[model samples]
Target: MTKTVETPREREAALLIKAAASLQNIRDTWPQDFDQLSKALTFNRKLWTIFMSSAAMEDSPLPHQTRQNIVNLGLFILNQTRELTMEPQPQKLDGIININRQIAAGLRAMPA
Candidate 1:
C-alpha cells in the first residue's frame, strides 16, 4: 500500500524546503559578504512577523488597506530574498583597488 501525506504537513514541508533553498542561494551568491545577506534575512523575518500579526488583528475600518499593506510587505520580502540570492560576491579590497585604478586609467585615456 502507498503512504498518503496530509495537506497541512505537506505544505509545511514545502515551506521549509523553500526557506532552505533561499538560504543556500544567498550563501552561494554572497559568500564573501555574509553580514549584508544576514541583515537582509533578518529584515525579511521581521517583515513576515509584522504581516502575520497585522493579519490576525481584529477587523477595522482600515482592514482592507491593512491587508493590502501586508501583501505588499510580503512581496517586498520575497523580492529581497530573491535579490540576496542573485547578487554576486564582492571582490577583495585589493582586487577592487586594482579595478578602480584600471578604470581611472581607461577614463583618462578617453578623449574629451
Candidate 2:
C-alpha cells in the first residue's frame, strides 16, 4: 500500500480552510459564543501573519507581485480582524472568511 504525503501548499490550504470554518462557526453562533470569536480570530490573525512574513521574505519563491499581494491582503485581514474585535459584528466576518476560502482554493488549485 502506498501513502500520499501532503505537500506544504496543501497543508497551508487545509489550515486556511480550517481557519475559515472556525470563523464561520463563530459568526453563525454569534452572541451565543462571543468568546469563541477571540480564539477564531486569533488563529486567523496568526496564520495570516505567518503568511505575510513569509511572503515578505526576499528569498520567497513566489513572484514579486504575488508576494506583495499576499502582504497587502494580509494587512487588510489584520485590519478587519481589529475592527471585528472591537465591534464584535457578525457581518464583519464575511470578508475574512471569503478571503481565506478564496486563497485556500487558489493554493489547492496550484500544481504541487
Candidate 3:
C-alpha cells in the first residue's frame, strides 16, 4: 500500500476538517462533556488565530482581498469563541465548524 503526501495547503485544510469533526463530536455529545467541548473550542480558536496571523504577514502570497476576508472571518471567530467560552452553548460551536469546513473546502479545491 502507498501513502499519499499532502501539500502545505492540503495539510492545513485537513487540519481544519479534523477540527470541524471534533467540534461536531462535541456537539453530538453535548452537556455530558463540557470539558471536551471547551478543549475543542479552544483548539479551534488557536487554529484560527494562527491562520489570521499568517494571513496578516506582509509576504503572504494570498491576494489582498482574500487576506482581508480571512482576517474578517478570523475576527468573527475570535468574538464568537469568546462568547461561547462564556456561555458554553453546544449549538454555538456549529458556526465555527461551518466556517472551518468552508475554508477547508476552498483550500482543497485550489490547484497545487
lDDT of each: 0.48, 0.96, 0.90
RMSD of 2: 0.8
What lDDT tens digits, residue by residue, belong to model 2 across residues 59-81?
A: 99999999999999999999999
Top-lDDT candidate index: 2
How close to the true structure is residue 103 of candidate 3, measured as C-alpha lDDT? 93
- Model 1 alpha-carbon drift over 4 Å, by segment: 1-33, 56-62, 88-112
Q: Candidate 3's residue-wise lDDT over 52-109, tens digit each?
A: 9999999999999999999999999989889988898888988999999999999999
**Per-residue lDDT of 64 in model 3:** 94
Evaluate residue 30 in candidate 2 and report its C-alpha lDDT on the 0 to 100 scale: 81
- List the candidate 3 regions with Cα displacement exceeding 4 Å: 1-3
RMSD of 1: 20.0
- How many steric clashes does model 1 contain? 0
Candidate 3 positional error at 78, Å: 0.9
Location of the lowest summed lDDT over 10 successive residues in candidate 3? 32-41
Error of 2 at 92 (Å): 0.2
Ordered by TM-score, highest first, the candidates read 2, 3, 1
Candidate 1 lDDT, tens digit per residue, 32-104? 6475655545544554565456655676334677567656656655555455457634332223223324433
Question: Please, what is the TM-score per model?
Answer: 0.34, 0.96, 0.93
